[model samples]
Target: MALESLDRSPPPFFRVGFAPLTKLFFFSALSVLLMFGDKQLQFTKPIRAGLSTLIMPVQWLVLQPGQVASSVGDYFQNLDQAQKDLQALQLKQLQQSARAQQVEQLLIENQNLRQLLDLKNTVATPSQVAEILFDVPDPYNQRIVIDKGQTKEVVLGSPVIDAGGVIGQVTRVYPLTAEVTLLTDRDQSIPVMNSRTGARNISSGNIMSGTPLIELKFVPASADVKEGDLLTTSGIDGVYPAGLQVARISHIERRVDISFARIHATPLAELKGRHVLVLQPTGIQAASKGKAP
Candidate 1:
């Protein structure tokens, strides 16, 4: 009987206030009433707002590391893409610059060809256009090689002229090429007539000057030679045509010690031209359709 009177359960601290099912039903009803009152009246609105405000900074702090990582990744990706774009643009600009240079060079070549064609029409002699291949490698002579030769009916001693005047005379002929000796060459000479005074003289390349030079040989000091005199081919050599420009008297040195006057002339032709006209030698003008004799 005494044992039955003693409590057998745990202490009140461990005891539940209500059964589990009973607590569930009571909390459900209370939650429904609180929700209805919160929606209808404004009793818990300030408390909820205060709780959200208190939690906002914590939520932001929790998301900050992920946001920062995402921004860093985006920054690197944009930088890489920008660098690639810059490189591509630079390459394109270089290609455009090369193309522009090619176009400019082509335009210059076209202008030169047009000038050559115009010069071809002024002379009554049969002529053909020839391209200068390269300069002769001999340093002792001022000579050039042309593309036309025996195969093209390029005759020996044919006079070559550019847009300006006489440049050279064909010296050697091959099957497909020819060599031209310039007027300034050491062994080349031409018969020139002064247009101002009609005086005939022999002009030859000056051997005394190491540079290319043309001077009237053995002209008497009392002759009518003067500076800035225009000289043309006299056509006496039967090689060059008559009245073609050859040179201009640039300087004249009259010395009392010598009987002959020293006269230097500047060549009228452009020596560095790319194209020239090859004219039939005046001696063979009666030939058949400009064919070599």
Candidate 2:
């Protein structure tokens, strides 16, 4: 009667009858079998592929709303940013336009003065406006590639100048672009003169503390060169025209122990930013009689 009553009663729902070690052994065996089958038999391939295919649609459906929301949010954010940027660009263009008018007026006056002096007006050569694509990757080269190339009549050895001063020379030409060697590269040299005293010297570039600085070599110790004296190209090389501004004397060091004094010149051109107006060379002969205004 007692056994019958026990059987008739519901078995305890939370009873723990299995031996822990036995259960662990069984699970371990099952896992080992699964891993071995997966590695050696390739038994899971079809199952896994089927499961992947079955769940793919569901997974995509689950993510659809989030994806759509993210896309919409990004589009709106980008639109807002673009609008702000456009307004800022427009304002900058207006300021640049005003400044350009002033520059044009100055150029006109200079042309008139050249004409009156009966001097060869340094003919503005045909030029193509190009954007600097990138800085030269090699630190030793100190160059940049402009978008203008043979298609634009950009030739090698053409002098590249900005509004401030000479930046570099075009050294290599490609089908679609050209490379400009900056004035501050070690291999480059420019014939420069002290604007205040007409003393001629060669400026060579050297890197000091990772910054480009030009050292004026062969300058006489007695040369009247001083800090802040402006230096302009003498144009003796025929590569760079005469009277183009190059740099300003920044430091003059004269040591009795050294035969040559070390002179440093700060480049007039801004090396860190983009510049406008790279003058192309015209093969035309320079008229001998014209004086620069």
Candidate 3:
């Protein structure tokens, strides 16, 4: 009896109306029916539109930063691409301009060569085309290596001429390569004859004076030499073939202090190109059939 009098009933808080699973099933079924009705009858269209309109501002606000970031990224990418394109165009323009200048130079060279044809036949110095390898790394002497050597019948002390004029002489020889000392070297000297006046003088490189510095020495103050006179090889030196184009007198200054006139000349050869011609000195035999250009 005392145990029965003690309250055996659960607290009101524990009182249950329906099980959780039962409530879930019932709500699920109701939701399905509502969805079917909304789909088939358009019953919820107005409601959904109203809810969407109410939340649109919030959605846009949340995504605004990402949209702005995407736009900024695209802007930067386009700007970088434009800069690269501009740089490429500038490089292309420079290359075309260089090619145009080269073409013009080649045309002028062609015309001069045509005029020198008779002179070439008169000298009859057979020559072979050679390509320059690289300049010697010395700062004092202007020397370059060439692809032709003893193997190619390129003789030592042979004159190296280009389309325009004499460039250098082959001083050192190897089986497959040779070294050429340009006329501008301080130690170099060439015997030149004036094309206009037939005056014979020794042309020596004065590397200290000016660009491509060369000067005629021992020319008498009263020598029949004048500015703008073309000089050719005098053939006095057995090493160089006779009548090869050499240098032109740029200026002549007479000094009473010295007997020789200070005659400065510029080289006729545009020695900057890779193409060159090497001729075997008159007595030395060549292996390949040659042409004068």
Residue lDDT tens for model 2, 1-293 = 57665655556996667899999999999999999989999999999999999999999999999999999999999999999999999999999999998788678655544432332234245444466789989977788998888888777777776556778888999999889988889988988988999988889887754778888988777767789999998878767777878898888899887777889988887543343345555332243224333
The lDDT, on a scale of 0 to 1, for candidate 3 is 0.84
TM-score sort, best first: 1, 3, 2
Candidate 1 vs candidate 2, TM-score winner: 1
lDDT of 3 by residue, 36-70 (tens): 99889999999989999999999999999999999
* Rank list by lDDT: 1, 3, 2
lDDT (tens digit, per residue) of candidate 1 on 180-212: 999998799999999999999988876467656
Q: After superposition, how far is residue 106 of candidate 2 from its true place, in Å?
A: 24
What lDDT is reached at residue 205 by model 3? 81
lDDT of each: 0.89, 0.77, 0.84
Predictions: Cα RMSD each: 5.0, 22.4, 7.1
Tell me the TM-score of each prediction against the true structure. Answer: 0.69, 0.54, 0.66
Task: Give the Å error, residue 92, model 3.
Answer: 11
Which pairs, if any, clash in model 3?
none
